[model samples]
Target: MTTWSAPIYVYLWLAGMAGGSYFAAFLAERFAGYNQRRLTQLAIQMGVLPAVLGVLLLLADLGNPLRFWHLLAEFNILSPMSMGTWILLAWVAIAVVMNVLYRYEGQHGEPGGRPIHRLNGGLGWLQFLFSILLMSYTGVLLATSNRALWAGSALIPPLFVASAVSTGIAVLIAYILVVAPVTTGKTTEYRLPARLLTGSTEWAIPTRLVGRLWEAEAIVILVELVVLIGLVAWLGSSAMAGAREALNMLTFGALAAPFWVGVVLLASIVPLAFDMMSPGKELARREVFRVALASSVCVLLGALFLRAVIVIGGQL
Candidate 1:
């Protein structure tokens, strides 16, 4: 019998998203050049809410939320849950501080902003590392359960990480489209704001930034596809009956519809197709936002359904 509940499923999903957001933001800051500040700010903002909520949910699921502090009082290096609790506590503090600093920098316009920005950047790296650990921790927690569906293989962590990244990129893309200013002309258009975190810059900068983000999202989607395939293949070849049973449940059993319709098609394939056919590159700025918005919605839905199917299906 399964002991986990809906809250657990949601907790897993939110935790992964939070981790992925931080990792994505860190990457944007490191490689996105002028766009780093905006992405970093967006990433941190995106991460903190879900993360804090997820942690709260996890604690609530314990029946007495305050009991979570017990884990902190009693340290156990060998316990995944204890470690995760500590990590969550640390991440929440860091995320809150980062958000406050980022908002201050943006509003005040670089009065001693350089040092603060650098400090945030340093913290971003910590977030990046913690995010990966957090992503892996969810799977590790499941695997530690000794259930054949989860414990039969070590691939769950990698698969979860890949999906988390793809979902994170989808979220950022959606956010950019929703929040960024839109510019349209006869032949060229831009979807991001003219003035980013550093202040008013040329339109060309954000244009290039969007292009890079699009390309990055595409790459992450491709990677997710590959990882999903590999996970299935590994499960198929597993000698454990439990593993094979879990695989069957996911592929052709009660959960098949969601796995196929939500995870494989809507989340992965649809977005890929939309990216290839998006008119945003042309004069259709509206079309671009529409496509991005649609894909992001799909990815987010798929991610939620993916977690639901996996958690519930495993028990079934």
Candidate 2:
């Protein structure tokens, strides 16, 4: 298999993040009641912006942004490239639709009800389906390759999916902490006590919402941790000599710093620890914010570091 450039790895990672963010938001929208609409809407809003950036980066990587449509001009079911191209295109379209409908709901609809659009259910399913495909595609793109480290690896898809979702949650947490406080718009029916907004309380958003998202993120990180270890063990036990060597590189070799410090310590363990200790009905907001900020920064950095290790290690 040909070595992919840094842009390719980033493209795959960012695309997964974009999709995963929408997936997390979509679930919030679907299951949570209408009162939490603000949170869900904000989370939903996170998807399109990153997706647009990821697409633009991909176009730039192709050397001529205009020629991107050529990718859509073919349909090769047997090719991972073809599958990814169409999946992202469709995922972007679905995200745009979801955003448009959400905005419309915000502007001209009953304040205390779920989105009234008739196609909402169908559109949501598409969003959910495509997000899963997009997240899985990132890892599949690598695994289907002939590279010894990735060829027979069965865990990359699940690993990437879990990590993508956790990072998506991190993005939501970071954004809400920094941006939601200053916003004056009353777009949803959800209301916070004056204490929460006035800095007297321990929370920025409601306790239930914050608790659920943190819990979800922590759970996904644990799953990712398990998958990561399993991937390492799989590589260690591989028949191919290169695969075993790749495992060593991740554990105690050239790539060890990023793998251990960046991914294991910062990304998984540190964030997981913070998340598991999530405050209950009362705690200092700054304390929670600090922990969240640290976790978010760590997860985002760890994600990039992980892909770097995987991509560069595969080549080595």
Which model scores highest in TM-score?
Answer: 1
TM-score for each of the candidates: 0.87, 0.85
- Tell me the deviation in Å of residue 207 in model 2: 3.8
Which ten contiguous residues of candidate 2 have the minimum total lDDT? 194-203
Instruction: Write the residue-wise lDDT of candidate 2 on 19-77 in tens digits.
Output: 77767766864676644345545555577777777777778878667888988899998
Global local distance difference test of model 2: 0.72
- The models' CA-based lDDT, in order, is 0.74, 0.72
Give the poorly placed runs of model 1, Cα more than 4 Å off.
Answer: 107-111, 184-205, 279-284
Alpha-carbon shift of residue 162 in model 1 (angstroms): 0.9
